[model samples]
Target: MTALPGPVSPPPRLLMGPGPISAYPSVLRAMSSELVGQYDPFMTATMTETQELYRQVWGTANEATLLVDGTSRAGIEAALISLIRPGDRVLVPVFGRFGHLLAEIAERALGEVHTIEVPWGQVFPVSAIEEAVVRVKPHLLALVQGDTSTTMLQPLEDIGALCARHGVLFYSDATASLGGNPFEADAWGLDAATAGLQKCLSGPSGSAPVTLSERAVEVIGGRRRIEAGIREEGDEDAPDFIRSNYFDLGMILDYWGPRRLNHHTEATSMLYGARECARLMLIEGRDAVMARHRLHGEAMLAGVQGLGLVVFGDVAHKMTNVVAVEIPEGVDGDAARSAMLADFGIEIGTSFGPLHGRVWRIGTMGYNARKDAVLTTLACLEAVLRRHGASVPSGGGVDAALDVYAGAGA
Candidate 1:
């Protein structure tokens, strides 16, 4: 028989990657809280409170904000599968890997998908998306607010108003941008937005926080259907039922709403963690958290540049949470990344598709977004680069980062 694995003792790692980074300690403590009955009064009350906290996080007054018991991708599927009906024209602006993910999910929903592509490192201009909207006349425009693959933040401020003008529903996957960056769900006129706790929320990847505008709620409401075993006398299922049962937002909303309808058993510990993540964000103030991320992000960017590393993508459009730097010409990117992990216990990221083996992604967000974290990552990265025979100036990385903190008086 194979030997049983010993009690799970994973090696300590500083996740400076694009995602699945270090979760906040308070969040981990909350996740360890004892479980309770799903329908218990305390559980229901906590659920309601979590909803309220997320409203502040999303900057929305939408009544349908809630947690989906899965990763951020699950939240995206829930929104896409529920809102997009068969043959509905959906326009997707593809900038990076996540944009393709959105288009793929929409296709699985049987929507007539149309796409407008920009180069991997860039984002679509609002005028370009508006042109697509006019031509495709899509029922929904799905986009990603931040694509970590390229570390680019797509401008959403103008796109939402453009969608509204075109009478098109708008959805954005904000998994990588929400807490660390500025997101105004209501002010931006977004119909739906989804994010996971693992990124900017500084929590584990089990819960996805999602918010739907009233208009989005109405669209999802039209597709509601109670499962046969849970059906009530007055409940009416829709003729155009959502294709996916698990991803049906309408049923999920019912579970979170005042009716207290039973759906899946709540992931109790995850709910606790999710609540704490939101609670901490609200306590710090959203703008303050974004500022912290920005400060550290700038430091990291300066640090890498000072090490003579070429930064990837359009710097102006890069996300405040993550930055991608081109791998040196002669150094093996994967080997360098592995050395950083094994030697320093720091984990950076590799890019995807067109950027694969071309760039290394480093992140400064959530619990890891701090001056110390930025300085340490830069210091160790310089060591690793030098060991790999890449020319790196001594103290260049850390000094550049320190100068940034000094300039910010942080």
Candidate 2:
């Protein structure tokens, strides 16, 4: 007889990895809210509210702030495809995997992509990026603000000014850093920026929150096209319309803007979750949330170093949400990771490309960036290390973390 599977259930896990960390409890509840018809007045109101909330989150006055109904990468694709016409020159500075991803996406958009690279564990200096910008004379500068692969946060403060000076449009993928780290889209002079809710926003990865400045809007507006079935009497489609229908930001903006033109039926549940994520961020106050992440992040750093683990990357420029620790000699990295899941129910992460199997990435972000979470992970990690025959100091991790909290009067 064929047996049917039961209701799905996942094991309890402390997600202390680079992303997709444990979501905030309220966000989970928000997703389960009952749905409404896509064009229902209530649904539209919620959509408008979500847009306004994300404006505060992105620190932008741009009217194009809204959600892209997919993961973080969807936002990146939408921005790139909409902004880059075929044969447009695009410059990307590669410091990690995601920078390479930006370049690849640009290539697919029929762009003439040029990339300047630094080593895996480092970030490019603003001068080097400017030098590339001067040479390439690109139409757009695409960059990744916080790349988890190398645990590096590229400094964007000056890069935007460099782009402005060069008359190049600036875009950044802030998926891994947005909520937990400090990001000011308007203040930083970013023409466009995108992020997902999964990382520091404490929500599942489905909806992507995006914002665009007036300059970006003007560029995308030139490529607007209404589909055949949706064409109205006065509608005029551009000759060089955006290539991908799903990723056309112009059409998306019309749908999300005052026109409220229907593009596709919105993802209702994901919208609810995304709204709650931004609501929580605003209610807690941005400065307070940033400080919380910083506090917990420092504690985790102190804890890991106290265990005598050598951290990878330039610590000074590391993102406040995640850190990369070198795998001790004689330790089977994959085996230890498996044991952490099997024995302790904690999930850290493995590196990619050059750092694969060489370092473990530990994250202190979102809901899991609490004092208890940090201490528990450090204690369990110390136990796991001892069981794997690695010499570890007794109570070293926890004590060090506690000292950090105590000194901060937390």
Candidate 3:
């Protein structure tokens, strides 16, 4: 093989896809700050600060909050594996592909899984989950707050009350909804909630932020273990071992606890990035950042409609970041997307699982959730469609989006 080139560089482009929305400049700058070893005092302090930032973002006072050293799925695994023992029952209310993923992971953790699926493009009512819980009497009730696969937001406000009344631990994967939608961890009675920075947080996707309520913490601690490496020979009997070594929430908590036991080497750059992402949102105020995403999403929806594309999903229940658009006939979805990236330097996404080839998912999230980014994406999309033999009114989509932005005046 030929020797590698001196240095590799990447072509920069506007990211307007379903996830990995463009990161804020501050987030990037934070990642470039000086690096330190995992146990270094400054590094550990930074980790503490990062946890505090996410706690504010999550609107929770739970003391077991910390970042998983992997993506959103890592957080999900940690929550499931630590809480779900063999033969324990878990009830999953599925609305999209990621819901299936939750069930799969819980099953691997040896849960006796039960599922009730709403239609692909719809979410269940609180009564539905409550009814299922009553019938199934499961130990845990798991769902996703917003499933980007369908571009639909699952309403959790009332579900929490039902779970609390029924005595089932509530868990949710808020990977796609955390910042774009209003989420209150404690108020909603969420026992465990996890998310990644790739979506509305506007950071790289490596680290996952997670929090657990006191009740959930008690359940997880039931299976905790004293690490042999640190335990004295005469110490009290060790706590029961968690199912998976790597996903042991107890061990992770210890690493982030007062004792500072060693876990995986945290992703330092990602920690910096995640910290700054939360910092920026905190500075903007959570409600304001959510409003910005909402306005941009409305403008994008209007622009897509002006371009003669049909918007998908239940409009009233959709999230403020991603929009699902119906693909028109006689045009190749993959080809148009490739053209958008290659010619216009804009990235859009197609659906996953069942919705594949039937819809195009365009997102206005995080740092890209702005008027300029929204209008530019609309303009480029119009150009790509026209060049690819689809009909479009000249300056139609862009002008429509501009009108919305102009009216909103931000």
Off by over 4 Å in 1: 225-239
Which one wins by lDDT: 2 or 3? 2
TM-score head-to-head 1 vs 3, winner: 1
What digit string (tens of lDDT, one per residue) describes model 1 on residues 137-168? 99999999999999999999998889988899
Each candidate's clash count: 0, 0, 0
Q: What lDDT does each candidate get?
A: 0.92, 0.92, 0.89
**How far is each candidate from the true structure, as Cα RMSD in Å?**
3.0, 3.0, 3.4
Off by over 4 Å in 2: 225-241
Local error of candidate 1 at 327, Å? 0.2
The digit string of per-residue lDDT tens for model 3 on 277-346 reads 9999999999999999999999999899889998887888899999999888878999999998998888
User: Against the hidden reference, what TM-scores do the models get?
Assistant: 0.96, 0.96, 0.95
- Residue clash pairs of candidate 2: none
Candidate 1 displacement at residue 51 in angstroms: 0.2
Give lDDT tens digits, candidate 2, residues 188-243. 99999999998999899999999999999987775453323344455443235478
